[model samples]
Target: MEAHSVQVREACDRRAWVRDSDRSSCKECTKGFSLTRRRHHCRVCGDIVCHSCSATVYLRNTTSNVGRACQSCARPSPDQSTPPPAVYCVICLDPFAAQSDALVVTLPCQHAFHRHCADPWLATHDECPLCRHQLSQDRTAFLEFISF
Candidate 1:
């Protein structure tokens, strides 16, 4: 048996962006988007944030590439609850480590992947990679917020 280790990179952008209609305020600042304050998605966490809440940070995947990242993701802080980039796109098994502008997507089953990987995969399988939950069975209703 041989031991192997894999490295992963966090994507700076998400292919399946949280629909503009879905978010009314910046996820970080919680400020409403206005003419002066526009909506920008954080490349790191795929969160919609206002300009003040967004930071132009160096992409973790590449040396020369830079992209917009959210305040929380720009630093290794205490917000571990905020999900990091997918370890690897299940379909391609490609680590996102060096991809500065990769497109990421989150399935209804709660699994995330690179969009390029998920699109073709879902077209053929029509089911989640890890859960095997059929996409056709997913509900149309979008829950605004979860209550614990």
Candidate 2:
């Protein structure tokens, strides 16, 4: 008899896809959006897509995790291990140096910000206020890496 191994799904939170406001139409089809038709996000490219244009796939992680992926994400790509560059907060322009007690948060793009300042801004926009870099999916992991 041959032994079989069952792959377990890794615990994860969904990646924050790009905001719908960034695009007026589906990225894949380039079809214009309307009130009735809603916008969806591709977990891979973080682009706004339509229901017909998106498909769910298990992306590479510790174990394959299900996520809404675009056609591009479904394709394989070279693995990236190098960490992103570290960046200072653009909102305060001080890189959390203004206050010793300030809570700093680092986004996926490697930009850092005061948690208090970033909280309100993040509510309205997903990108960094200064560099306009998109937020990463593994926000918690990034936060853990930078927390001091």
Candidate 3:
């Protein structure tokens, strides 16, 4: 039989209609995919998301564009055991890369502090590293009391 004749016979048996313009037909159910009509594009793959299935994409290591991703791919997995980079001292503008020689003096507002400069500076004053909240005398007294 001719190729076209064979194809026509097959299509007739399946009773499937060809939709050239509409791409939202669900592959599983052969029905309209729901999410496509509401949003501009698929939230995940940037494809034309239909009503039935639009996925959100979430990545742990990298940031993603919002409002385009769908739910199936949302909620990125937990990150690896690698710790984030250390913070730098705001006052001295020094990067705190290691724990050694670094004094973790906590501020009154519960902010991280450096010991090298803050300890000596607090000798005569009691202010926060950034906000300068008067904690120098109080901190000194507390330290002196603790040492005893």
The per-candidate count of clashes, in order, stands at 3, 0, 23
Instruction: Please give the RMSD to the true structure for each candidate, in Å.
Output: 13.9, 16.5, 24.3
Q: What lDDT tens digits, residue by residue, belong to model 3 across residues 1-148?
A: 0000000000011123334345655432355654444423433333343444433222222222113233333323345332333376666877654655465554424344456656666665655657765442444443442121
Worst 10 residues of 1 by lDDT: 139-148
What local lDDT score does residue 61 receive in model 3, on the 0 to 100 scale? 24
Query: What are the per-residue Cα lDDT tens digits for candidate 1 across 13-33?
Result: 467567788899989868898
- Tell me the RMSD of model 3 versus the true structure: 24.3
User: Model 2: per-residue lDDT, tens digit, 49-147?
Assistant: 887786554344522233555555544344634344334556766544544466666554445666777777766664677778654345443333233
Q: What C-alpha lDDT values do all the predictions have? A: 0.57, 0.54, 0.39
Name the best candidate (by TM-score).
1
Cα TM-score of candidate 2: 0.37
For model 1, the stretches where C-alpha displacement exceeds 4 angstroms are 1-9, 62-64, 77-148
Q: Order of candidates by TM-score, top first? A: 1, 2, 3
Q: Could you tell me which residue pairs clash in candidate 2?
A: none
The candidate that achieves the highest lDDT relative to the unseen native structure: 1
Clash pairs, candidate 1, are 9-96, 9-97, 12-43
Q: State TM-scores per candidate.
A: 0.42, 0.37, 0.34
